[model samples]
Target: MITEDQLTSQEAIALEEKHGAHNYHPLPVVLSRGEGVFVWDVEGKKYYDFLSAYSAVNQGHCHPAIVDAMNKQAQTLTLTSRAFHNDILGRYEAFATDYFKFDKLLPMNTGAEAVETAIKIARKWAYEKKGVKEQDAQIIVCENNFHGRTTTIISFSNDEGARKNFGPYTPGFIKIPYDDPKALERALIENKNVAGFLVEPIQGEAGVYTPSDDFMKQAKAICEKHNVLFIADEIQTGIARTGALLAVCGNCTCEGHCERQETYSRPDILILGKALSGGAYPVSAVLADDEIMNVIQPGQHGSTFGGNPVAGAVAMAALNVVKDENLAQNARKLGELFRAKLNEYIKDSTIVNLVRGRGLLNAIVINDTEDSSTAWDICVALKENGLLAKPTHGNIIRFAPPLVMNEEQLLDCVAIITKTLGDFEK
Candidate 1:
């Protein structure tokens, strides 16, 4: 019976390898603790956390305000199962709907669940409102999009690893090339049953593949033209990760939520998760105006722990941290500096190709084939050099530090990254 304090990193890794499901291929280092933008391995070595748990910790790890809110609510009440209305659920709903400027919200526990919820809502809207024949409502998705791993989500995914044998995959989804508004319009014109056009404003899992600047605006316009819903999955790109409050907000620079600006391409259905709870609890939500959201009636959809009191408290606190700390503005500022510095370093570098992304959610492409291990090796070196990052889509390494990170800390991490990459230069 070894206590947590008595376990070593090797011992912990072995235990997981032996007992846990082999779903994830995590980095070799075993982190024991995290705060702000830094994490500590079991051996007490500290490193900058450049991944920020896939941007789930945008408010930063172990944020006191969010944790305190969770603690206070847990002490009083935790779960009510939606059988009876809890005191805090309404308040959270009101606050969140107001904060994000949505007419209603449907809470869930994970990003996948929220995405699933949005799909269901879209399908229902298609049948009841759009008059698409039942079971024939088709939703449009993009190629190379990483929505989630659920059965329905993977049904439309291009990732062979996730979709291979995961089916007979779910059906009624139309797939098209991403970042192409003309393709989107063609799809809508070809299919009369397009209930919604589901897209990631900036594709995060596809190695941070950012679309053109006007992609969102143009797509929204096309969806409007065809009366199809414009759904934005902001799970990984939301909560100020992309310099804006939501990636769909486009170039708006307001510190907090504001009236829908000309730069903003408001989604008909907004799917959010990750930073919603500040990494303190599992909280995800689907938001829309009443005309769209109201389609979900009693017993049609829900989760027992979806709107639990603790999640409600933690989410409100987390959103406050984003606004009170001015994280959106900070992410915008630091992200510019980070890219400029990295661009300067990669000028004559052969191992690195180019940097691409919006705000802090950026990635650097390793000058190697997708099948090559150079990107993974560079990440391992980065870990050894007191920084942590991971590769995506083979040869691309995503670098998203916590939004709470200060300028000095960001520069320090930048130095560590550049130095580590130098070790892998051809």
Candidate 2:
């Protein structure tokens, strides 16, 4: 039994090792508090939080507005288990539907659950509306997808670590290489029973694999050509993380979903999570127009805490903060500066091969191979230099700070990052 007084980072880690599930590999820092763009370790050491908890805290850690909304709602009604009507759920639903420009929204509490919800919706729509034979409908997903760790979601994943022992895997999914529109075209054309083509506008967990510039537009076109539902999993890349309202928002800055923007590739179905609640609470949502969404009848789908009052209030305030603060515009301008700065150093560095990403969601490829520890070692050095980032795969370190960050803090972080990488020069 551990005592409550002055537990060191080491002690906290030890306690976690003793009792917590060993499912995640995390950095050694033990953070106790956080605010915009920075977190304080238990020892009161401050560091730039570059990961933003995998882009979930894009509004910044412990954002005042989100916290206030959550606190205020907690005092009223927390949950009614969907058995009774709550005053806040309708207002939230209307707000979210207008924000995303969808006729309906299906709310869940996590990215994974939202993804599962999308899959079920698409399949049901296929059978009931698209005229595909029951149980024969297949969804086409990109390779290296990190939607969620649910059994059904992982069934389509080729990630051995996430897939190895978790089978007999669920079926009805067809996999294709990401960023290849021709392959997607061929797959859709060849398969008559395809229900949907699910993809990440920017594949986040898979080393931030950004597809070709025309990939989204072309994929949406192909899906339209064949009547396949275009499902975009923006769980990691959405909510201004990629410099736009969504990575699929393309060149639009119209303060809305950008359905009018010709450059935007509006998917038939959209899945969102992460920053939806500004990391204050769990809130995920799937959106579609009436023709597609109305297929799910009353008894077909539901969740206990999915559309609760607290989640409702938290998500509304969180989204309002995104627009009111102009985080999307901030991410776009700073993303350009960040990449340009890193590229300048990368030109002369032997430890880094390249840097690629949109908005603040960027990554640097280490000179070492995927199995090398060079990226891990460099991250440790970064922690010592008063910043925190993590590797996605083995050799790629993702640097996604909260969108609330400004120019000066970003440059300071860049200096810390470049200086740290300089130590690993070969």
Candidate 1: 10-residue stretch with minimal lDDT: 251-260
- Per-residue lDDT tens digits for candidate 2, residues 150-183, read 9999999988989998899998999999999999
In model 1, the number of clashes is 0
Please give the distance, in angstroms, between residue 389's alpha carbon in candidate 1 and its true position after superposition.
Answer: 0.3
* Model 1 residue 263 CA deviation in Å: 1.6
TM-score attained by model 1:
0.98
What C-alpha lDDT values do all the predictions have?
Answer: 0.93, 0.92
TM-score of each: 0.98, 0.98
* Residue 71, model 2, lDDT: 99
Error of 2 at 208 (Å): 1.1
Those runs of model 1 whose alpha carbons end farther than 4 Å from true positions after fitting are 1-5, 255-260
Alpha-carbon RMSD of each model: 1.5, 1.6
